[model samples]
Target: MRSLFTIGLIASWYASNIGVLLLNKFLLSNYGFKYPIFLTLCHMMACSLLSYIAIEWLKIAPMQRVKSRLQMMKISALGFIFCLSVVGGNISLRYLPVSFNQAVGATTPFFTAVFAVVMTSKREGWITYVTLVPVVAGVIIASGGEPLFHLFGFMMCIGATAARALKSVLQGLLLSSEGEKLNSMNLLMYMAPVAVMALFPAALYMERGVVGITIALARDDWKFLIYLLFNSALAYFVNLANFLVTKHTSPLTLQVLGNAKGAVAVVISILIFKNPVSITGMLGYSLTVAGVILYTEAKKRSM
Candidate 1:
């Protein structure tokens, strides 16, 4: 049934995304890789290969037409933004606790909504706007009402969040365009390679020389490599699910579900790292999770 497919897709999407966060925590902590940009490059490379092969071999998209220069260029630019979303988040982990990182991420759905309106020139209802307030408030509470984790570092988190928001909006724009046909595989094929390339110079500069890059890769711990692979797979998994779910459900539902990742992420983070959970944190986490579920339920009823 259509409904069953939608349910399964959402479930798979959430699992993969939350899995990525858990693996990312491992990546940030264990990898000898020093540069955010460099680590991101490595991650993007892994995704690129997987996507390219899948798109070409599986022929995921219908043979509608090849994308035009203008559309391809737009996708490339969004690719760069996507790179920032990862690198910036990687950088943020250096300054903030993993739980804190996940907490701030709770605001993603609200920002997704705002970006949607701006990108599509569409109007959202009052209830939709009202729902965002609680999501955000929960995030603040979860963060212990902390101000920026570190001045520059916290700013980087904000940048990452903004990039994430933009990615969501841009995805809507790109996917909805009349002449553009992209399966999830096609989009990732275009993005991950280009994004990896875009990060090379930044990564190179940060490392200062080939020696730095060599040293980072030379350690080559098996455990760490496994984690990196996990990171790559998780990144692609949720993404493919995102596309498939979009086909079956509404974007608004996807956005709402996306917010719950923060809660799932926070719990796992606390389990892995023994993160301190304050009363405020408990309250915030509960509220954020409840709000996202409520919003999704309300949306389903309306439909």
Candidate 2:
């Protein structure tokens, strides 16, 4: 049962991430700038509600221990930071293509590996550094090499990478003390609510009144309400899955999987939205996959 739970948790996390990315791509095409804002809110809220039910009704606690107040506060703070990075990364998407955003997100593995070394004091072998070369090269190729240089969107991708890496590191930190209790469901309980709350100031500052939301939604400018509601639900579980994947697998494998997300998301975005991708972008995507494989191999050997 324990092993099955771990496998299920990992499968769900990857699938959930793919679903969230696809949803964001769909919502973005129909709705304009505000798509991410409300979507982010809905995502967190739905996830929180679901998580609460699972905890209370289904008894989905990951482990035995209940968290301390101080610990809860710490988790909340990390949630806030994670949500903020997500918002920033999503906002960047509005300016750039989804593939581009994802390519940038590939950088998360690089950031995670570095941070792991620094924070956890876990040192990778010298070969690990060499492995990153192809990953970086693949990302560059996947980003449409020259076009990325012309567009500022590349920077946004970088931001997404940083945000994701930081979130992963933060999650690991939260798990440090409460080792047994740090399962995916357990982490989601506190973090989801805090992340949802993190969106308020942005929503307030960029306030679109009830009428605007209605019109935007009704006009089919985007399934505004549906996007909001579903996203909130999806994001919570998506995050929960993340913890499970990281805990069950090697962090490097998680990074590789995370990097592949961009490759998969780009293809999905293009197929679903008819988003254009250059030859270089295709090459980059291929290279990224290669890079991930190479890195994974290096990691395996080091082990």
Question: Between which residue pairs do clashes occur in model 1?
Answer: none
The CA lDDT of each predicted structure is 0.72, 0.69
Best by TM-score: 1
Listed per candidate, the RMSD to the true structure in angstroms reads 3.6, 3.9
How far out, in Å, is residue 49 in model 2? 0.8
**Model 1 per-residue lDDT at 204:** 71
Candidate 2 achieves a global lDDT of 0.69
**1-303: candidate 2 lDDT, tens digit per residue:** 988987677678777887877676566544553456656666677777887788778765644455577777767777787777777666666666667676666656678888888888888888888777777887766655635343545675576677778777877776567443456666666677788677766675675573366565667745566665576567776766775587778677676676666567777777876766778877776776676677778878887
Worst 10 residues of 2 by lDDT: 144-153
**lDDT tens readout by residue for model 1, 5-101:** 7888888988888787666666566443546676678779878876666566776544334457888787888889999999999888766667777
Model 1: residues >4 Å from true position, as ranges?
Answer: 1-15, 30-32, 60-65, 145-148, 209-220, 244-260, 294-303
Which residues of candidate 2, in runs, are more than 4 Å off? 1-15, 33-35, 63-66, 144-152, 179-181, 207-223, 240-262
Residue 140 displacement in candidate 2 (angstroms): 2.9
